[model samples]
Target: MSDSSFRILIIGVLIACSLTHVRSDASDHRYKVGDVVPLYANKVGPFHNPSETYRYFDLPFCSPDGIIKEKREALGEVLNGDRLVSAPYKLNFRDEKDSAVACRKKLSEQDVAQFRSAVEKDFYFQMYYDDLPIWGFIGKVDKEGKTHPNEYKYFLYKHIQFDILYNKDRVIEISARMDPHSLVDLTEDKEVDVEFMYSVKWKETDTPFEKRMEKYSLSSSLPHHLEIHWFSIINSCVTVLLLTGFLATILMRVLKNDFVKYAQDEEAADDQEETGWKYIHGDVFRFPKYKSLFAAALGSGSQLFTLTVFIFMLALVGVFYPYNRGALFTALVVIYALTSGIAGYTAASFYCQLEGTNWVRNLLLTGCLFCGPLFLTFCFLNTVAIAYNATAALPFGTIVVIVLIWTLVTSPLLVLGGIAGKNSKAEFQAPCRTTKYPREIPPLPWYRSAIPQMAMAGFLPFSAIYIELYYIFASVWGHRIYTIYSILFIVFIILLIVTAFITVALTYFQLAAEDHEWWWRSFLCGGSTGAFIYAYCLYYYYARSDMSGFMQTSFFFGYMACICYGFFLMLGTVGFRASLLFVRHIYRSIKCE
Candidate 1:
């Protein structure tokens, strides 16, 4: 096809996709009644203001079969993606009295007799249709009835049922209609029982109830619109590219001059030699303090780096999304567990190279440094969530499962990695041998210090990714679906490149200034981006989002902190490796005898 024709065809495809995403009623996609469809309740307070305090709590009482069709706005067709469970409850549509009695039996005697609150509260039901949650208020309830004292009366919900017609393939037609009169009422005990009297047959028509049901699907997925911020991405990329080019040009020019000067000086008649990075080659590679700890961090960071890369690749390929619920979380947990071996191996190898003898201590520190803090933070946050009756809180069983995964899968792999790492015979090769004692480090100005270098290094990497970070935060906190994995993967690569380049530049400058303590500084310089990310998250929560309640606050900050820490480790490792290579290459270039 010609370029214009291709463009037109692409646009046509996008429009078609946005208009309708047809899916077959296959076993996996098809939902049945009484199959335990997940229901999320959004509780509203006085004046029906949505209490954005707690996350949706699962209501296991009613199994609702609904279709959550997400509109592919770019393509103009709706795609059927599953974000939530969509099985329906098998309600034996019998007499009202019998249905009520059956529902009453499902609840405890105390629950059936007692009321929750005196004032009526608005609880919205988030029905998972096609695995997408379409939230709507079902009914109103008052603990103390306005007319009857100590008695509660629940209002009934009346919504139109979407009758979707398909030719023979079970694919939904664009002209779908909503047949009015599907009713359900909440009893005094908060039990859900459908009103069989209000049920109706499939009413096929060209148009029913004002607009087509497809409009509702479009609106439902509106929040999750694929917003490709092209300008922001381009701006970020250009800025980072410019900065990278400048740093590379300066480093190359300066290094070339230094190499020429050193070579000329060495061949001169003068006995005295100049002092710089070359002069301290022996002490530069000397074992840093807390060697064991450093090795462990490096190992874990490496593992995390690999894990992130793999996950992003999978996401980009569409293997883990648009269908599976909780797949990402499950994948992360599993992958991280598997990568524990990598962590242990890298840490142990580095420690052994540093001539560390206490293997047990090294191993323990490697495992505890990140994981311990993570678990503790999660526990504290979970406790707070539980206390506040938040649905965001992880259940006891889930916690147990996570713990078991770590213990059985991760722990054993870590041990195996440690053993393998220890058994390896690789030598810690340095260009120059270290002296008996450490060199006396000279004092430098504030700008030349490690802290300042780290701050500068971190800012560059953060700047490269800050724009993408906003979208990530929105998707996580705003109940929006982000499907731009290709763009995200590109941005991720850019972030890595920027991080490595800046770290190398900063490390070289620091070393040139006679600062032999570049080991930890290099790591910190790259890792400090996490600090910036965390700071951004705080700003996002307070300034951008209208999120309230202790649970939401805790969950956001708590998980964000953990994520930032991982970011730190990953970037820090990148920085350290780049600097290490730079140091080795420069040292080897000089005639250091």
Candidate 2:
């Protein structure tokens, strides 16, 4: 196909996909009485290790018939380890059942062993009925046994009581309650007769369907957590304000005086050897080495920045709710893929501006810069999940689909963007002329070195978000559901402001110390925040959370590494952009003849 035809095809595909939401009968949500309400049994996993999940039938659960039907799920749902399959229990809308035996099976020795293992590990099963999710533990452990003082007893929860709340035609809420009376002891060696029973009670509620998910967000402890988030946000705001104040002082008082003195000296024709940043004006704006890599980072960072803002905006508008499984992830994947063009354009244009000749190489690098590492990490983690037979492993079809999307949709857009960027490329507009020979950077004290300056630059920004990071980690790794996007949005802005101000300040100091190598240093200074974040991840994994086991640990670190790498790119871009502007503004203000 021609380039234009391919572009049109890609755009059409994107539009079609975007128009398609999660395929579900629950979209309308208005159901008549006696309408079949499909109940889907999702995954089962140890409650402590959320990442490690298995198909519900992976256990010796009673099967309905010959071949169980699996519901078609969105990309996000599949990625989230949700395997929605038809359950044995049958229920209709508003059709309440007093009691019904779902299935009856004589447990074999192997079955008993599996149940015992699951019960001992505190395994929980998830189910969905009419789009509302419900969770219940498979079994329980009793520490106080009748036989001995310190002996433990394991019992399976054989009966499930489903209390489903409805408002007129719409199902508002659902909860699965286990009955203690129906517990079966797993201590016996003989084959046990297990009758899996369930009771459905439909209750009428005055709550509107729109407000159904409010209950999840209004947990008793949520207010306290929100209060803490508010306090942390306020603290970050104060920090940004102080940093901004310091930057303003330097810009208005120190830099202004220097500019005025330099102007006077130039007017008087007094060329008495210049000092400080004024002497190195020729080399300050010189394009750094590895122009392609720098440009690629900037491009990838730009794309990430845009993606973050868009996702947060969607979240604030309630496009992604806590109850909606995989909506956020789905949105993220689609948005990131669609926005590949931005990365290509920015990276290619910047490279061209730096007088880079390798357009094809730059475009390829920009396309793979972030996705390469992410793909590798995902492959490793997915391998581990597959080895463990965990539901977190992507199905072969899903992996193929993701790869196809990247190759067809993302790659084409990136190439088109790079072509446009290269065709429209302009020269680097530096205010000061460059000298043939580079200026020798003076020896600086330990604190003024790159590492120390990066440490200082990264610490301030990391401090702004460390508290918020705990909440994020809790939501991502633990069982907590995060819904405070407004607060997250606030903290996000604060982090950017803090990063920009701190990086600009550090760049100014570097220039004052006569270091013409501020290009990579500025990027590193901003990117160093990722290092601090990774450190916090270690602290959180070891001390703040109870997450263990090889699968969960690998998944956690692999994904966190990807997230922190993104942070490095995004913040590093922010820092570099800010420093570039500062450098340009200062150079333009002075007479550099």
Candidate 3:
């Protein structure tokens, strides 16, 4: 196809995608009601407002570990540390007796019984503390608080709970009456429930519903908890111990043996050179190809990574409308597009410094990989959303607003800044060393080496939860309600454990695979989890998903962004291991000499 025709075709594809995207059902894209209940933990103060508070809590990304740490790390402040955030607290649906509307003397005898019956029926209630809903943490009365029947205490149960049974025919207000931790339970260690003091008065006298608060974290800690997370936290120390013991044994043998095989010409006993760890410093910073292509790629990768993260973090903070839930479609588009600029400038500048090659081509290629695809993908989505009747998408007015921000605000700033840019060579540091003698580096046996094997280990755990992973990605691109934070947190923990275990095991495995070659292989072995992550993402799209056309077109480009991200992570891991291995090799070799 001609260039213009190709462009037009791409545009056409984007439009189709936009239509399906716009048609995406927002409600379904949220947390499902499979195992959810309402509680009031996060926003604990009805203080005096007799009015009830009801908000829907989506459960996407709801995992126990995440709930504990999400805000702790990001916000630098966790407001409700004591309050347990959990679902299945109590969900109240409206029935004949739900409101004051049914409590009047004017009500007929039939109506009064019907309303009372509704009130007596048990239903599940979800907890809404502040703006965010709790996925795991549930509240209970403190140890000292007096015991109240299921009626007075608003609790979120961990395994099973005791609450009023639900009858769909009766009206029940799934609301709490805030109360005091009555002094009746003065004896410590008793299982006392948290109290909810209601603000209602006889004939409605003075104060509003008497509200008070306390969280319900059990005094008991599960040290052996294979279910709760912190168990893994302590196990790391054990892992370190075992690793240390095993490696110490290997080190004892390796050091005593007069083995300098790679460095010698059959000199089994030649005293090894006593040297310290030194990186190939001079050429360390040099571009891989001494050309601009690699430089541009590296730079572009960095830029895209930074921009994408910024948008995601912003979304996490609820900066976007409808909070974090509503911003995915736009966040995906903006993050991808914004990263292009980062990629182009970084790639071009680094390449210019490394190769002293043509800058224009480097810039263009970087832009193409990063910026070009992004624009095309987004444009297609915009068009398709319009066609598919997705009114929730950015409207024309929004488009105008976006363009104005892009052109006037962002573009002008970048253009002006580019003029005063740093020196091309200085932009990237030169490699510390250049090889005066070519050394033949043998490739470590793939499965035999520790690092590669360790890297391989990430596969199993990735497989264990690959189904959930597939769902999450599909939810993001397919524009579905992706609630399920609780389980996702579990998945996240699994991935972490898998990666760490493999990395540690591979450390020993590579060393055991072959002793001397342990240095580089060890790094590669434990660090290559990124590759598996990439493969799985592709597998999800190609094998598991039959996404919409717009999503399909957007998928590859979005995927490449992920791939690029994985590659760098792998690169960093490999680099760290290699550095550590290099140091060890030098240290022991010198000690023997």
Best by lDDT: 2
- Count of clashes in candidate 2: 0
Model 1 regions lying over 4 Å from their true place: 1-123, 129-132, 138-228
| Per-residue lDDT over 1-593 for candidate 3, one digit per residue giving the tens place of the 0 to 100 score | 13543353345334323322221112222222232233333222111111111121221112323342211111101111112244322333221222221011223344333322222222123344222222322224343364654334232222322222222222111224322332222123223332221121111122222111101111112333223333343343344446456655765565335245334523454453322112222222223433554544455546544544454444344333221332344444444443344444555554555545576666555545444555565576555544533322244555675567466534443332222222334443222343554333235565654544644655544554555655556544443334434445555455544444445444443333323343334334433555666667667666665433443345344545555344444343433334444334533443221
lDDT of 2 by residue, 483-573 (tens): 8888889999999988888998889888988999999999999899998999999999999988789999999889999999999999999
* Global lDDT of model 3: 0.38
Q: Candidates sorted by lDDT, descending order? A: 2, 1, 3
| Model 1 residue 50 distance off true place after TM-score fit, in angstroms | 12
- Residue-pair clashes per candidate, as listed? 23, 0, 84
Give the least accurate 10-residue stretch of model 3, judged by summed lDDT. Answer: 71-80
As for TM-score, the candidate ahead, 2 or 3, is 2
Residue pairs in candidate 2 whose N, alpha carbon or C atoms collide under 3 angstroms: none
| Model 1 Cα shift for residue 549 (angstroms) | 1.1
Off by over 4 Å in 2: 1-27, 145-150
TM-score of every candidate relative to the true structure: 0.74, 0.95, 0.41
